[model samples]
Every structure is written in C-alpha cells, then in structure tokens.
Target: MKCYLVPCVAGFIAFNENLDIVDYELFPRRSIISKLLEFEKGLTAEEEKIIKRLLKDYGKISIESVHRWKYGKFKGVILESPNIGGEYLRENLREILKEIGFIKDGEFQEIIYEIHMGMTIKRLEESFREQDKLIIQAVSTLDDLDESIGKFVERIREWYSIYFPELESVKDHEHYVKLITEHPRREDIIKLKKLPRESMGAELEEEDIEIIREFARAIRSLQLLRKSIEGYIESKMGYLAPNLRDVAGTTLGAKLIAHAGSMKKLALLPSSTIQVMGAEKALFRHLRRGSKPPKHGLIYQHPLVRGSNWRVRGKIARVLASKISLAVRKDVFTGEYDPNIKEDLYKRVSIIREKPKKKGKKRR
Candidate 1:
C-alpha cells in the first residue's frame, strides 16, 4: 500500500510498492528548466502541489530521494523511504515517458539532450553573473603588478644612479620616478632638491636622458594602473563581502577568494583549512615527514596575527580564522553585515595578548 516518489526532469512519478505506476505529475514543457532549477535548490512549489494532491488520495506517501533538502521539507507529511525503486525508474525512464506520451518513441533521447543542454546554459549564465570572479582576477593582477613594479623600480634606481647617485636616497619609488621623468638632467634635479652643485656621477647625453625619462614614464603608468586595480578591489569587496572585508581586510580577503577559486568555495572551507590556506607546501611537508606543523599561513598577513607576540600568535591565528569562517558564511548565505563579528574577534585577540608569557627553563 506504500507509494514511492521518483523525481525526474519530466516531472514527479509515483509508483506502488510493486513498482507499478499509481499517480504522476508532469511539468509544463516550457517551465521544465525553471522547475528543475528549483528542484536542484530544494523542493519546488509544483512538487508541493503534486504531493498535496497525492496525499488527499493516498493519505500518506514516501519519497525515495537522496537529497537532504527533501527530507527537511517533508519531515512531517511523508515517510522517508529506502531508494528501492530508484534504479528501476532510472533504467525504465525513457520507456515510461514514451508510454505517458511525454515524448514520442523516436524523440526521447533527443528531448533529454535538449533539456540537459538548456540546464547547462542556464547554470553557466548564473555563474557568469556572480562578482567574485571579478575580485579573483583583480587580486591576481594586483599581485603581478606589485612584483613587476618592484623589479622595474629596482632597475630604474640602478640605471638612474649612474647619472645622479644622490637621487637613490629618495627611497620612495614613486617620488624617485617622478624626479627622473620631470627633471631628467642631473643639474636640474640637484637645483630642485637643493643638493650640492658638484656631481660625482657621469654626465649623460641628451639622448640618454630622453630614453631614461621615457622608461620612468612607463613605470609611472604602471604604478597608476596598480592603484586603480587596488581601488577596484576595495569597492568590490565592500559590495560583495563586507563582513569578510572587515574581518580579513580587502586585499587578504580577495586573495583568499582567489586561492579558493570562488567566494562560495571559500565559504565552504572549515576554519582549520582556512587557517592554512596558502601554506600547502608546509602542510604537505608536515604530513610526509612528521615535522612541526605550520602555525599560520596566509592568515599571517592579518595585523592581529603578525603583530602578536610569538607565544600567542598561533592562538590568535586560530581565533582569527574562526571569525573569518563565520564572516564568510554570513557573507555568502545571509548577505547581512554584522559588526559583532569584528568586535568579538578583536576582544578575543586582546584576551590572548593579556596572558603572561611563560618563562622557559634555564639550560643546565
């Protein structure tokens, strides 16, 4: 007397304990994609309506599904059943559709292919709409820019030092580049910066100064581009993951997302994994050699962990990672900005900092 529900792309099919078709509900042909999307997320309104109709006749029913979401929805109304009929239904699905006039005899495979293609396209569009991918690209580009700028700045310093060694003391790369581009002549730079008139470095030809000035201009453009990308990441992080931004800071949060491949993937990671995200090599070494495990990873970039005393840094990293985990989940699921996460993280970090340092035993 028990009835089992088997969900399919075409619709929901009911079969008796003997695997005989007892009741069924078919989705509208045009709405199958939408209904299937809803089903993938959980149960759909169509499913509820059909289940209610069946319950009126059968009193109670059973669902043979592996999806936990189904169990959550039907807890009180339906008995959770073993998947006894699932295999039979899957194997015989094409024939069942043909018998029920859902598809013509020759078109079952063709129709199924079309439905799958539609679902794939719909899912792809949804993935493209998310902004996390933009953040990943921006952060990756920013890191590349930082590396390239560092190398170029060093080269510029060395090359320009040949003509005006004193400018090397400027220290700041942007200011150094500005001086070279704006006042390529060593005498002009000395006059502008109020340095001594006597020059120990070699004098460069006008042609040589022009080339160095051109190179400095290019470096300046790159610096500007790097700044623009950083600004983009800050704004995107504020919009997409405010809680994660507040907890981890914009650049670190974006790096975490890039390392995980997506915000959703980052959100799925447990606190332990998040703590050691960028230290994969160290983790593997520990696993293979039984050496001391790393105390922190990319989370070490957080000021709380980096500035804490070595004795309590590991503890602070753990607390920070836990808060990051909560922040990520809230950002991904609730999208609500909760300031308490930041407050609680700082409070716990302060408590760890206050503990007295343990004195080590003196060597004999």
Candidate 2:
C-alpha cells in the first residue's frame, strides 16, 4: 500500500494514500537509451567483478507502483505520474547515496544493509513510455511542422510569384526550395534550370533574391528535419507496435495510439469503436442530430479506403478497422509479429472492393 519511487536521470513517482521513497538508484546522470544499451553491451568483467558484491545485496529491480500494486498489476492504474523532478526525485537521498558508494575498511555491508533494499528492474514504466511518448511526439510534431512549412512555402510562392509564378507550379516542395536556394536571382535561376520562362511577374533585385534564398534554405532544412522526424517515428512505431504498424502503417497507427491514449487502450477497443476513433464531431452529430455517422475517421487516409470507389469505401474502412483491432491486440497483448495480418488485411480489402454493390430499393 506504500508508494514506490525511482530516482535517477529521469523517473516517476505515483501519488497514493501511502508514499515511500524506494531506497536505491537505477542510474546516475544517464539516459534510458544509454542504460538499455549498457545492459545489452554489459559491464566489463572488471566492472562486473566490483559490482558482484553490490549485486549480491541488491535484489532485482522492482517498480513500487502505488496504484497498480494496490489494486492489481496492470488493472487499476488510477492516474499516471509524470516523470519525477528531473533534477532529483529525492534531494535528501543524495548525501546517503554518495556515502553508500564509498566503502571504508570493508564496511560496505554496514552502509548497504542499513537501507531497506527491494528490487532490480532495469528501469520502470518510464522507459517503455519514453519510447511511446517519443513516437507520439514525433507524430504530433509533424502537424505543427507541416503547418509552418506550408505557410513558409506558400509565402515564398506568393513572393516569388513576382519573379516566376511558373516555378511554384512545379508542386514539388523540395525541388522548388532547392531551386530557390541554388539560384535566387532571376537571371541566375533562368540560366540554371530549363524551367519555363513564362511569367508576367516583376523581377527582383539581387539583394531581394538573396533574402528570399536565405528563407528558402532555412525552409529546406526544416523539410529535411521533417523527413528525419518521420523516419524516427516509423522506427519507434515499428518497434513498439509491429503488427499495428504493418497493418495500419506508421503514421495512421501512431494516430490511433495517440487517439486511444496508449497501445493498451487501443488493444482493448472494439473494432467498431476503432473504426470511428477520430470522428468525435460526427459521432456527436449522429447522437445529437440524427445525422449520418462517419464511415471512417483518420483511417480513411488508408489507400484501401481513400482509393476505393464510393460504393466500397465504408466496407473497406470496416475491414481495415477489424484488421487494425486484431493487429493492435496482438501488438499489445502478445508482442509478436504476425505477417499474416498484413497480408490478410490487404487481401480482405481487395475482396471487399471486388464485391458487387447491392441494388438500391425503389420507393414510391
């Protein structure tokens, strides 16, 4: 019934009726990624030899989760505690921990045995959620990044409309930005690319074009940054939810996880609910105004649904949702990769598309 807390580079402390400081340090001034790698790489034999005695005293890492421990593991998590103060979870323990490291004249047991020790978990839920949060944040960042990039590009397009409106018609953001960066001047730009010279736009001075090029180069950097962020999100998503990633694709699967708040929640959802995850507005309308409910939410972005003819769109959404529901369950519950789900999902979408639409009833 006591609160268990981990204090390290970053950790969590749940608030319950009882709060107790767990006596130990997981890692000192190190990140979760490094710590994980360290375990995989393992300590040098010399280092291991030194910690052998310390390891003898320290049991496995046990996360003293106040909420989950009270009710049951994974069942009654009242509320998630944020990462404990980054600087230090417990300030007073600093002196004690520092002293504990120093063993004077074989008195290591005296210092170690004095404190009540319990667990040896590599880290806690923070490590798991750190990756989840990283993925979620990367996915979320794309929205703001997209808007900023779009606004910048749009402004550039309009501004450069004076120099060359035809350039904007290229519709390739990267290429367009590259052209601007490489040859900002009207005459130079004309010389470099075989692009059309047809524009009724006014020409700009070299000074003006240089300023525009500076902005274009900055925007291009952001475009590259956007691509990198997307790659990171995909990598994290694939690791965290391979089945979901395979079936739903990275961005959409991350969206579903974000909407559901977690993979656990998404796994628990019914296929019907998963189908309408982002349609809160339409769902409200269906309840409040007797309007037609949405057939798909964000998942409508899937090619199977978006590319389908109108007749089969809803069917595709339904089948896709069912597969996603299954995929997520396996991802959360089993943590195993099921290649068949991806194959079967696309197959089902194809079958659904080929099925002939039923005739509409003729009413008087």
Candidate 3:
C-alpha cells in the first residue's frame, strides 16, 4: 500500500511512531529496487527496506493497492477532499506531478500494477528457459545420433564386406541398412535375388548374419530416435516461437532462439545482431585479430541462403536476418502470426537467389 501511496497526495502523510515526518527523500539510490521506486519522490530508507523484503516474495506484494493506484484511484481523493491539507498538497504538487509526466501517461501506474501482479511472468519466463535448455539438449542428442548412425552403418558395410563385398558395392547407404535389418544372413539376402544376377559376395553362415543383425538393430533404433526428436523440436518450436518457426522453419528457428538464450533477449537484439546468429567464434576472431568480419553466420543454414550461390549468400543472409528480426519482434510482443511476412520474405529471397551476373572486360 505504501508503494503506491508514495506517489499520491497522501504520500506526504508518512510519519514515524513519534509523529515525525519521514521524508520520502530518504530512499537510497544506486540500487535496482530503489530505481524502481523512483516513481515515488524521496522514499525513506525504512520504506525501501520494506519494499525490498516484500519483493523478495512476489506473493507478498499488495494486489488491491496496486489495482487502485494503477487506475489513479487517489486522483479524485486529492481533487475532491475538502480538507485544507489535501487541497494544499493537490494545488502545490499538481505542477510537479504533471512535470514528472505521470499525468500525461499511465505508464507509471502500469508499472506499479505489474510489480504487484506480475508473478506469473516470472514463472512463464522460467518455463521458457527450461524449454530452451531441453530443446538444445535434444538437438545435441540428435546430432550425436546422426554421427553414431553414420559410423555404425560404415561398420556394417565393413563387417559384411568379406562375406558380401558385392552387396556393399551395389547397395547405397539406405538400401544396405534396410537389407541388413530385413535380411541379416547372406542366405536370406541372396534368397530373393541380389541386385546383380552374378553372386559376387561370398556366402556367409547364419551366425555371421546374426552378429551383423545386432548392430543394424541398434542403428535402426537410433534413427527412429532422431526422427522423434526432430518432430518434437518442430512441435515445440511452433508453440514457443510460432512466427520464427514460420519464417525460419522449426529446427533452425529453435536453434536461433536457443542460441539467443531467451525470446525476450532475442527480441531486444538489433537486426545486425540477428544477422550473425551463430558465428561467435569467427566474430570474436575478427574482432581480436582485426581480420575481415565474415558477412554471414549460421544464418547461412537458412534454405534461401544455403541454396543460393556463394556470390549472393551474403545478400540473402542480410535480407533473411532483417526479416527474422521483424518476425522475432512480432512473436515476442504480439504473438501474432502473419503469413504475408513469411511469403514476402521468401519472395524476396527468391530474387536474391538469382546468380550474380559476370562483369565483362572493358576495352580501352
């Protein structure tokens, strides 16, 4: 209650038990909470302590008092009170209050309201941070899964090479994986008919095939997990950053948000910062060594940038970064999804994707 009254005409009524006026001027400066308290004039040190203690547990803040103050509930009290002190305070302080611009805007009252009732925002932000960590962790797992799947498949080829070198030469990575999973034994693989009519691969015993099958089974499981994480990322990113997802696609969009640490932090960034989404190492190197800064970063992974020729990668990245900046702001502030933004951005990207023209040599 004192927090709101600190700015009202009644704020002047503060007194200690001895009835001595406690000047609002006593509030300390150079501290975070004191700065928030700056809306009030000259709050005393004791009052600042109470506010700090109350704020330590957001639930303790007075909601009713904040609601009343947020609507300028005391404005009528100061104006309508017939009391001489109220009239004097109102007349003498009106100019100062107007000068402070509190009368011109309800922004200060809104801040007070938020302080009293903004606990949910803290919880939601915590939830957002947890989700980002989980997404990053899942993405890392998927990356590892990819590497493991590759290595396991390569081993599968080597293991079967002596028995069915012909199969290794004929089948591509995917088909070989499928054949191993479905027909681990040489007898089974050659039963239907190999790709080539001539059996170039030596026949293997059923036991040799069983050993290979165990490894194939594990790799197949890893692939399924990778697919699951990809889908999970897509669904979660859509929920967390819908506009970013629409503009950047789920995986890259989540990567961008995760890289930024939080949506609010990302939204606060300038378009230039968004431009260099993931080139921290290169950027730091350039800054330290006075080397030429790279034009693009991980944003090059965006389809528009990646598909474009190197000559135009920088241009496409710039445009994409600018659009992503706008999209991120939209998602963070309004949570509104506008398809036109995505469509227009891709249209512009298409034009940028065109190969740069070669310059002809000039004759003197």
Candidate 4:
C-alpha cells in the first residue's frame, strides 16, 4: 500500500492510495495557526512524532519537499514528485478532513483567515523591529532642513548686508547668524569683531535691526534642528548598522540606506549596484547615450574616496563598495561587529594610494 503524508493547517494526516485515513495527528485548537506557520518553515517536532508513529505500521511513505530535511534518517521515506499524489490529496483532503471532524463547516475558512492575519502581523512586527524606515525618514528630514537653512541664511546675508556689508566677509553661516543675533547694530559688530569703523553701507533704523535679528534667529533654529536630525541619524545607524556606520560614516551610511529603500534591500544588492545607487540618472545616461560611466556616487562623500587622487578614485570606489557589501551583509545576517572590515578597507586604500601615478607621453 502506497501511503502519502499530507500536512494541513490542523495537523498531519496519513492516507493510502484509495484516500483512506490510516493515521492522523491533530494539533491543539489554540496552536493551529502557530503550528501551521512552523510547518511552513520546516518539519516541526509534532510532525516528527506523528511521522515516527506512522512509520511503525507503514513500510513505505511519501512526504513533501518541506519535510525532506529530516528524510535522510528515516527509512522507506520517499520525496513526492511535484503535482503527483500530493495534488490529489490536497484536492480531496478538504472533504475527508471535514468528514473526520478535523474542521467544521466554517472552521477551515477561519483558520485561513487567522493564518493570513498572523503572517501579516509577523511581517509588520519585523518591519517595526528594523530601524531602516526610521533612518530613511531622518535622512530626508536632514536634507530638507539643510535646504531650508541654506535659503534662510542667504536671505539673512542679503538683508544684513544692507546695514553692515562688512558682515558679508564672514563665510560661515552659523557665525554670521550669531553675530547679527547677538549684536543687531553695525557699530556693535565692528567693535566686537575688531573691524574698521568705515561705513560703506547705510545705517539701519532700530526697527530694521530687529527684523534682521528675528530672521537670523529663525535660521539659527533651523540649524539647531539640522544638528538634532544628524545626531538622530547617528544614533540610529550605530544601533541598526554599526558595521556599515563604521565602514561609512553616520551620514553617508544613512544616505545609502535611504537611497536603497531599506537595509534589507541594500544588503541584497551587488557591490556595483551599491556603488552607483544614488547616481541612477548618470548611470541611465551612460547606458542610453554611451557616455562615460560615473566612477562613484554618494560614496564620493566618504573621506577615503573623496580625498584620493582623481585618477585612482574609481579603483578606490570599487574597493570601498565591495567592503560595504560585506559589512552590510554581516550587519543584516549576523548582527555582530567585526573590526577587521574597517582595518582591511584602510589597508587596501593605502596600497592603492601608494601605487605610482601613470606617466603621460610628452607632447610633440
């Protein structure tokens, strides 16, 4: 008698070629969904017990691919080919299962609904556990804050230049804002910063100084917000992807994750893809127009890549991308920090830096 073992949401069922139930094992009512999920992943202990019990009576049995993991030790166990007896069992097993009181009129539908809900909740919980989503948002907010601060600083410079044009010499936006906010009068600024008292710009009314000071205060607030977002990104990257953070700094690592959509997606990408992730437009232009391919993308922001000689940046970018790939994989899979990744990366970069520059032919 050829017997087949079929797994159901309720439990495991063994039957003969004629669809006669030879033996069965039903899980507890409360654990039906949990057991079903475990069974989907692999053969569970409950399944092994039932299979062992049936093996005592049945000389030969066929099992599905999911159960093949444990098939090596079991004698007389055959792996059922695709769409063979298993399909027939699946088609007719519902009726047989209902007849045997394993499930009632509406119980099967309920089990399926519960399983769907359970899996959906599981996926949602996993997503929540991963901080990539938070990192993406933080990076985006940081970018927006940067743009806002830039525009506001430009406006402040223009407005303040009307009163104290000498202040325009201060290139740092934060210092410029501070100078105006603390001392709204041109005389006060010149005396405090030790500048000449010559006046090329018009003297503003107290009202105008107040207005510029308020504008500068708003820009200062934005700068503070930008710093806070940067700190948030650093904390999140340290916790979620310490290896990536170590390989790439906090801001660059967060940008990579944001551009890749998520850490899981980034971890799966090839080194080449990761290297050009933020330069999709340039890559597409190269493919479409036969232009020279880009040597690097967002990773160009990294000191190791950016500070290198232009001629060798491509090689360094390639090496950096490869190390980043390994780092991200370890971050996602093992969650253990390996210090060698950073050390090896620096070693390779130094070797590339030491290579002699190629000599060019003299012009005739």
Best by lDDT: 1
**TM-score of candidate 3 against the unseen true structure:** 0.59
Name the better of 3 and 4 by TM-score: 4
Q: Model 3's lDDT to the true fold?
A: 0.61
The TM-score between candidate 1 and the true structure equals 0.64
Candidate 3: regions farther than 4 A off: 1-129, 169-172, 191-194, 353-364
Candidate 2, 98-217: lDDT as tens digits: 444533443433333222111111222235534565566566667777998899888888888777776766788888888888877655666676666655678777778776777787
Which 10-residue window of candidate 2 scores lowest in summed lDDT? 116-125
Model 1 lDDT tens row, 18-53: 988887788999999888988988877777887877
C-alpha lDDT values of all predictions: 0.84, 0.65, 0.61, 0.81
Task: Please write out the lDDT profile of model 4 over residues 1-364, one tens digit for every residue.
Answer: 5678877666877778776777778878777767766776777887788778877877788876655666778888888764245676677755767876877764554455455446433432444555688788778767876787788788888888888888888898899998888888889889988888896899778878886787676677667657866887888888989999999989999999989989999999999998887888999999999999988999999999899889889999999999999999999999999999999999999999998888999999
What range of 10 consecutive residues in model 1 has the weakest lDDT sum? 73-82
Whole-structure CA lDDT of model 1? 0.84
Q: Cα RMSD (Å) between model 2 and the true structure?
A: 15.8
Q: What digit string (tens of lDDT, one per residue) describes model 3 on residues 258-346?
A: 78877778889887888887888888989999887877877878888888777888888888888888888898889888788799897
Question: Which of candidates 1 and 3 is the stronger one according to lDDT?
Answer: 1
